[model samples]
Target: MEFSLLGPVGVATGAGELVLGPAKRRSVLALLLLQPNITVTIEQFMSSLWEDEPPAHARTVVQGHVSRLRQMLAEGGAEAYGVELVTRGSSYLLRLPEELIDAHRFSGLMALARPESAPQDAVSLLREALGLWRGPALSGTVSGAQFAAAAHALEERRLAAVGALATAHGALGEHDHAAAILYAEAAANPLREGLVAALMQALYRGGRQSDAINWFHRTRQLLGEELGVDPGERLTRAYEEILRAEAVATQPPARTQPPARQQPSGPVDPRVQPAPERAQQPSIPRQQGHAPAAQGRSPGSGTTGGPGGTDSTVDTGSTGGTRGTGSTGGAPDRSTAPRFLPRPPARFLGRETQLAELTRWLTDTGSGESPIAVVTGPAGVGKTACAVQWSHRYASAFPDGQLFADLGGFGEGAEATPTAVLREFLLGLGTPPEQIPPSADAASALYRSLVARRRVLVVLDNARSSAQVRPLLPGGPGCATIVTSRSRLDGLVVTDVARPVPVQVLGTDEGVALLGTMLGHDRVAEEPDAARALVALCEGLPLALRAAAAQLTARPRWRLARLAAALGDERRRLSLLSAEDTGIAAALRNSVARLSADDARLLSQLAMGTGREVDALAMAALAGSDPERARDGLDRLAEMHLVDEAATDRYVISTLVQLFARDKEAGEGGSPPASTER
Candidate 1:
């Protein structure tokens, strides 16, 4: 049996196409096929089916769809081909090889076509890939907002493949063929500057210099009027090249048989060549004036830019450069660019899955807009560490340099205001200090204009809310931004389409490995059981694990069992997990201190409950409040990561967090009010 998601979701057997039931069932199959061999959680299915507002019985509905799909597959002889719909825990997995899915085949072909050494092979592979798209992806399937987003992403991939195919043809001296392919695609996607630039290049090379120049002017006018931004560096370079005298009169290729491939090519112009690394956008021509520095200053220096540039102190003066004009009147020297990422932790471990997701988001060619990813979790779950590590690993992708800022959302001081961050970003991007706009809106516009044409990564750490990160986001497709926050920032997900990546605690094995990395392998090996026990006591939190490992390392004579025993005591565990500057207790305390009195009281009461989980009704009985109030309090606690919603309304507080809450409760001598308790 073969699956198709390139158009309508379907299953095909030797007999013919099988009849998949209802629209929702087809949608379920489509979602599963898109992520073949991976688990699609029930929650994800519901979200994609109904979007933000799911029905109360969404679980039952999703289970029905899955059951129907399984029945259809089985009747269609999917078992003969080794297809299986397996239920794993709270998720469902559709087990199928990559070859069985058309979308996967297309992706595979595109990957094989990316190398510069294989233009002929690329042309063949890309042609096959393009032929697989029967129509708009997942067409005629049930549509929801989430499903629409996924379908849009698939369509974007198809267009990118088209662009790549044309590039491959051009490399083989088939300019007319490239021009024909790009012409139709460009008309279909007017906002795609990369496609537009490719078409312009093809037209100029095909002896239509005047027509190419006309297209450039039309594109520039459209982009400025629609997006309020000029044509990107690639398009601008193409226009400049066309203005040169020698480039005006190249003869058109013969309309007969195509010329044979030859190896006499000297140096290829980088501007005209397709950049497989950034297939969604045309490659920017290398300019002569600026070379990015190898390293930049640490964040929070009140100044950002190349070495020895002026500091980015906040200025409230009305006198500044015009909006959208990156003036350099008082700007720092442009010899060095700002590289603000902090060095990643030496002993970083785990998060392999999350790193892969981030990589895909950064390199995805389907979306025409700049990608935004939000890394969120409780304090010390390693959100920042994971982001920094990935940024450093892929730093070379953004040669223009990385920009880093600490929003101070959960730290000691006031949160870093968006205006302040924008100011620093503009300065770091070489906008003169005097030319920086005083208003945040104007500064943001200027910052977007400056980085619109460059490939850069902006890491916004500890963002308090969506509004805080919004102004800092770059406008164009050439950049990607990663924001780490304790809050989930749901508003950003809904409004700005930011991808939310929740970082969870490590598993037992991962926690143990981290301890081994921090402490000596021999030491952990000496007391393997004790090391596992310590990990359990620390609850697999990176900060707690690091703290425990630091204490043992500082006192080499202390046995791992002794440290484990110390952590076993609930009353003293928080203190035991504090070593040097790393303190899990301090972090929890800070989070609690920011909460309202009612929320704090609710959290403490819930922490004292007998079982690991509690529903809103039980919480209300315990807290002597109505169910509505109890539910609201629980949601607030969950948002702050003090309590996690294990399943629906059932909430689970981690052992370590419970201990902190209990400590506070004991200190306050708090208990349920006599009238409120059952």
Candidate 2:
């Protein structure tokens, strides 16, 4: 049987086509095929399927799905040859090779469509590679965490295909054709600088000099207007060449074009943030008219920039370093503020100790290499506040502007696409929109180029996964990132360098102090017992404390004691603490609601289990898995901030979460008896 999953999940045989029934079963099959000949493990598979939330009996359900898939495969002729997709220890793996999948074919064609390939061959290969895309990847699957991630991966590949095709056309010397094709691609995906740059370079080669220059201007405008960023270096270099070539012909450049600027020999700007390790050169700009009909040449390198900003240089080559008008034509200065960015809110009381620890970490950057610290905790645990406060305090340390992006690990809506975020970032640094690359890889390169030598602080808030954060991380040693999320970024943290700092609830004293700040010493002191009870009920969570205090302050008739009485009832407590929105209960729910059914069930079981803290071993026993697998489940719980790791190898749920989880378990007829082991 020829198994396929690179694009579209399918099973093939010489006889005919094999049907992979149902979307979820197909998804499980696709995932299995993607990792052919390897076990996917139950834990990893579930994580892929549900992300954070899974239904009760998700495991049994997955098993049923997998069994159905295997049965389908068998009916489709796999049984004839004694070939079958089967479940192994913890995971399922398909028996297949690289040649069977369309994904592999696409990758193979991509490799053949290199710059050196003949025009005809390159075009053919590009077409072949593109042919593999059969609508959005896993089109049949339901919208969930696994599908979301798979879709993102597929989209990345699609963009890569566009870039490859454009490059092949450039090599084939069809500059105009390449430019036109890339133009449409860029328009559709403005965040991809590679596509944008390709179009610009093609235009320049095709002798559309004026058009190239205009493209640079338009790119700058779009980037600034939309994302507050600048054009990338590749686009900058391509436009720079157009200007220089025009100068040599003794032809006056368009009024919009700046005079041929001379290249500066030193570093660009001291305040510019550097790029991450993998970004390519800048994007290409778009011109209104004029399609040059010249042959394509190797992409030039040199000092390229957006609007008035000078792109950083580390001695790369470009089409004749004409140093033309030190900046992209008609571009804005890089020093402008983003149009829609709101001023940060002020910090409140409590978190003195946590703040100090953060400061220490900031200062500890002196230890060999700075750590990419993750501030993770329950929602409303003040993770964002702590990160923001620390960033504000240490603003002087990172002279570059503070970069912020919310990855939306827990919320809905487009969780700031990495490319979109990069575009915004580059525009802010001064890249023109037209010049931006139409590919994530190219944008990442440009970002790294821009920040290769600067000291910058990047704060990634609400990151959904390591993939989202990977592109946004700045490249230089001088750069440090602080990521805040309710979910623990296990993938990033496990990579040896990045470490996680799990933010716990405020200590008892700190919680009381925060309440004091809001209710006043006189009021809090007058109801000391009530205040203590209130803090206890809140589980010493900073956000819960603040919300409780806000509630009391809002109602003059309600005394602290009365509020405490309302909160003492577990079920009514969360309901009582809840406001229309923006309260402890709401925050916790936001995190919890994002969970997959499996995680929710595990959490409920945890609440039904023993002690203030449970180790991975205990959870594994309760969840009926090994410690390693159990840890992954626990990490998911911890990310929702439903469970806190109070001690190394131990975990605890917030007081309210504990009560709620237990109540939920009982409501669901409770979990199997809590494991006393470990």
Candidate 3:
């Protein structure tokens, strides 16, 4: 049996291809195939399928698709072929050998080809790997948008392999073949400096000097117009080489002489050559139809004659490092200063205790290393808002700039990779794109080196795990890092000495204050009871309160009680608490989505069970599991802020979250008997 997601998602057997159902079903299959032998949670399926706005019945629909897929695979002799779709705790896993998946095979082949010692073999292997692509990956799947980035990354890998193959060809002196392969790719990705550089070099070596120069000018113009930046060092160097070649070609044969001798070794002037790390200073490119400037002159030193005999002195300090005939420098000031922090919310309230705790942790000097704080809570609990507000308030303490990144751990799209985050951080610190290393480890090392001794504040938001934030931490004692997540991040606390500061939902008074801030004080004061009732319905979650306030503000004539009345319905309250852009339901959904299958099932079961608090024994009865397993699942829920361990052996679920669970359980048409053990 063979599974393919490189193009249309499908299963193939020795007899024939199995009948994969509609787009949604094919999407499920594609997602499972993409990560074989791993359980994909129902929430993940729903998120990928609907892109963060799954319908109320998304879970049931996903279950139906999975069932149908399993039946189809069984009918196609899946058991005999060792291909099985198995159900686990709260997720489903597709069991298959790595060799059976084409994408996996392609990845393995690419990995083998990356080493330098086997260029010839790499060329053959890469060619074979590229041949596996039938068309756009997961093209026929319903959730194509969900896999758009993955498809693009896969295509990028293919193009990179093409580049590698061209290099191998060039190593064998097949310049024409290399140039041919690069031309198409270069044209397709016109702004790719590496591809353009490779193509330009190949063209020049293949005796197409004029064509290479033309390509350079065209690409430079396109980059300047589109990106508002000049080409990087690689492209500039390639262009300079072509220009030198052109200069030699056009010179009179009889008058031609050997090139000038190299400048004598001496103490390099600071103005002429900045520090090695600051080597990203942009060089002046000689204009076409103009006489080239004299070489070996100090940068920003003396005026030189241009094509029409005009004085052209390079301005070394021009912003973005562009050169022109001006005395002021063109290079950007504070090239290493990154301003990545997002703007703080306009009406952030509460979290005073959490903020004070974070400030204490950050200001403490005895820890002997840079301080790290993890701000964790359930979704919509204002963790991010609190972190941002505190950072802004204490921005003066850290004289250095603040760095921020949303890891997107729970985003509808693919989570941000550490390598990509490191690259962004490096660039933010004024590290030249060319200087930034390709690997995550190397980039992280460079980042630590840059931020060493700098009093910088780093905020890593929406982190999924400790591993994602670990690489981004600065090693300097003066630096401080704040991480916000739905997870408790106990690992960071235990291993990295990070102080844990949990951001809880607002108190009743605090919630009212927040609502008043958004909807005006008089309106909230005019109907205090109604406002409190609305706040109660929102469960004191800042996101929910703000959403309710927005809806009230939109309908000024509608009394606060009217809004509360609409929210009084348990079935419609979650939907009612939402406004145009903010919603309690959406925020709660993100938290629930992060739960494991068993944990999620237990949560729903508890929601359907009687009473606000459930003991371990009672939960065990509800889940039909042992007390230990039930306690473990409940503990996991508590860690996620989905439930509260109110006392010893007593757990309480939030009323709003309970509503969400009830909706989930109701959709599945199952309800455990009310707990009586407690």
Candidate 4:
């Protein structure tokens, strides 16, 4: 359970209730939880907790309470739920997901149970919202006027929920139950005209017209005495309709617009736009005659269903969704096809074997297994580029079009959530944003249904784990999914029978060809030996080669030998292989950022190994742990492609990764890395 502002203020866990120390402390936490994820200043805490007579050192007192609260939350491992208390200058923010707060969750349920929603769903949603309240709102935690007012507001909302619940019940033709629900709430809030109206309507619908008239009269008198006002429009309408013995509508008729065929997420939909870079990014290639992409596109849009090209209007987080040339036009309306494949990163290098294997796997899926290609390799080895290049190469094979999502699996940013990705995928595939359900599993079902027999290519790039990719995988054997990640994604292979396609760095000749293409052939032809040195220095990594080639292209006067010599210095080597702030160092930093602190420290330590190939015993000595622990860490690191097992017990720390680890060691003021490979 999360914070329970509807009844008492509390922070709870799976175990039991947490003792929230003092009343003032509970008050502080209650106020923060009431408005989670927003800045709450010390002054607001003081005002809410003490009102006019706060202590002289109120700020210090509030700060102490927050400090202790932070420690308490940390001890509970609240970070697992993405909950944390952040400090912003003079204010404090209690950040947590919406579902973690009872108030927010209740409010979300209430919003979900719209008058137009299905009666059963609305009833269930309303009852769940009502059940969140245990007792009087903030009963034990209200220290001052502010908390009392907050409690009053919540109680008022509860009355509205009760009325809505009654309306939902009536929609299901359970008029007796509706009258019962409204009676209790109406009695409690006699002056609430909406509840009074609902009670009247429910009573009449249950065939108690006289009882309905009597209740309305009682409420009318109470309202007059309380505020000297006549009954509101809702109350008057219900009363007039009942006197005529007419059946009155308790709420709007249930929506018949096919669910999942339109926006149903109501509010707070997690639909993702393409990654932020697409704003100014050059449009990726479309089929030869396809309409040009709308400028802002936004990649998260565009899902091609299958053979019929079941398409949807794409929303690229901008004014217009990308429109393909081959749109359906008619007298009623005209809609264009949606495209989601990203542009080729650069001129693709040699990956014919990898491409052939991908084609072969999909072809072999004739055995009835849906092919999910788990493309794993070291960072900067061109896994995404290879997949994209192949996708572009075989566009004709899947006329339904391609769907692409950058999972943001490995980077400084938060991982792209499955629900968020599913929303985007559904939006791309043909589902409207409103039809995209709030539930990850539900949206995923919609995805499977939409793509059941479609030959769409679902490419999930930069995935972090198998769990992240599982829900996004296409269900039909007619469709295929290509998942690229630094991790091997072994879980997918075991459970989903996914084929593992490993992409390594380019060959020396392949690297030269790619670099020569980026630079001019004349330049490489002029200094063939230096061109070879440039590729060799980069270990044939396409990303590194691209970065180097891009730089030389920028400075045409700079000789390949000069750039090659600069890269030879181990100190500047990683830094030299960068274009536009994205280099080997940055990629390594992102990869290390995802590892455990111990694993990261072990990585730097491993770089200090005695030789390129080291056994578990040697790693144990380097990591200062026993053999078993060292071996386990090595296995994990190898899974992430940071190290490779060269033999039964020996591992090879590639020269590039080694340099990155050593650089990290020095930057952090650790013992200098071994003069050479450890």
**Where does the lowest 10-residue lDDT sum fall in candidate 1?**
285-294
Off by over 4 Å in 4: 1-337, 671-678
**CA lDDT scores, all candidates in order:** 0.72, 0.63, 0.71, 0.71
lDDT at 524 for candidate 2? 89
lDDT of 1 by residue, 1-678 (tens): 788888877888888998887888888888898888999999998888885689899899999989988888888888878899999999999997779999889889988896257789998888888777765788767778767888888898988888887888888888876876787567557778888788988876875544465456556656756898877888777766754432223222223332222221232222222211111212221111111111211223232221123331222111112221243122222233456676555688889999999998886757878999999899879999999899989988877657887776675435666677776676566544555677878777767766766778899988877887888899768689999988888899999888888899998999999999988788899999998999889888999998888667534567899989988888779887864333787788767766777888888888888877999999999999999999998998888788899888899999988888888778768843222210
Q: Is candidate 1 or candidate 3 better by lDDT?
A: 1
Off by over 4 Å in 1: 1-335, 668-678
The weakest ten consecutive residues by lDDT in model 2 span 293-302
Residue range 1-678, candidate 3, lDDT tens digits? 888877778888888988886888988998898788998999888888886678899989999999999999998888987889999977999998878888888888888884257777877787777667655677777644668877777777778778887887777677766886787568657789989888988877876553565566557656766898877888878867765665555432321233222231322222232213123323442221121111111122212222222333222122232211111212223322444555566677778899999989998989679999999988788888888899889977776567777676654334566776775565455443455567777767767765675778888888888987899899888799999998888899988999999888788899889988988899899999998888788888888887787566534567899889988888778876754223666666666766666777788888887788999999998889999999998998888888899997799988888988888678667743232211
- Sort order, lDDT high to low: 1, 3, 4, 2
Greater-lDDT candidate between 1 and 4: 1
Which scores higher on lDDT, 2 or 4?
4
What is the clash tally of candidate 2? 77
If candidate 3 were superposed on the true structure by all CA atoms, what would the RMSD be?
22.6
Go through the candidates in order and give the clash count of each.
Answer: 2, 77, 9, 13
**Residue 244 error for model 1, in Å?**
47
